[model samples]
Target: MDRQLAERLEIFERTGQVAPEICRFVRTELDVLDAAGSEITEESAGTLTSHLLLALQRSRDGGALTEFAADETVRAELAGHPDALEQAAALAERAESALDVVLPGQEVRFLALHLALLRQREAMR
Candidate 1:
C-alpha cells in the first residue's frame, strides 16, 4: 500500500470511524487488485476504498442502502464488461463474508461500475 493510503487507513482505524474488519477487508481487496496487476495506488483506488469502507460500516450498523436504484447508463456500461462485473460481485461477496453483512444487489452493481471504471482507466494508460 502507498503511504497515503496506509495513513488514511490508520486514521480511520484509530478513530473508530471504520471497523478493523472493514479496514482489513479494504487492505485485502487492494492487495488482490495489486496482485491481479491492476497497478492500484491510493490515487487510483481511493474512492473505491472509501465506498467499500462506508458500505461495510453501514451494513454492520443496519443502515445499509436498501433502496438504491441502479443507474441505467452504468448498467449498460457494465454489460459490456462482464469480467469487471463478475470480479466486483466476487469482491462484494468476500466483503459480505468477512463482515457478516449482506450487500444489496444495487450496491454490488455500483461496485461493479466503479471497478469497471478503474479497469478502463488503467487500460487507457
Candidate 2:
C-alpha cells in the first residue's frame, strides 16, 4: 500500500476500526475530478485521503468545527466550476451516512477548499 494509505489503515486498526469502505468512495471522487481534467497528484491524493478520513472520524465524534459563512476567495477560486463544490458536498454527505453524524457547512467548505487547492496545484503544473 502507499505510505499515506498505510498510515491511514494504521489509524483505523489502532482505533479498533476497519477500512470503512469510505476510502473507495473518496477514490471515486478523485477519479471523477481527474476525468474532469483536474491534474490531481499523488501528494494531493494522499492529503485528501488523510483529510477525508479525519473528517469522517470527526463526524462520528460529533464535531463539525464551525459554521461557514460564504467566502469569496473560495468562490473566486472555484468560479465557473460548481462541480468542485458539488464534489465536496457529495463526499460530506457520504461521510454523514457512513459515520451516522450531521456534518455542518464548514466541513463541506473544508472539502471544497481541498479541491480548490488541488486545482491550484494543477495550474502550477
How accurate locally, in lDDT, is each candidate? 0.81, 0.65
Error of 1 at 68 (Å): 2.9
lDDT (C-alpha) at residue 28 in model 1: 85
TM-score of each: 0.90, 0.62
- Model 2 segments more than 4 A misplaced: 1-42, 67-81, 97-99
What are the per-residue Cα lDDT tens digits for candidate 1 across 82-116? Answer: 99889878887887777787887677777887788
Clashes of each: 0, 0
Best by TM-score: 1
Candidate 1 error regions (>4 Å): none
Estimate the overall C-alpha local distance difference test score of candidate 2.
Answer: 0.65
Candidate 1 clash pair list: none
Worst 10 residues of 1 by lDDT: 65-74
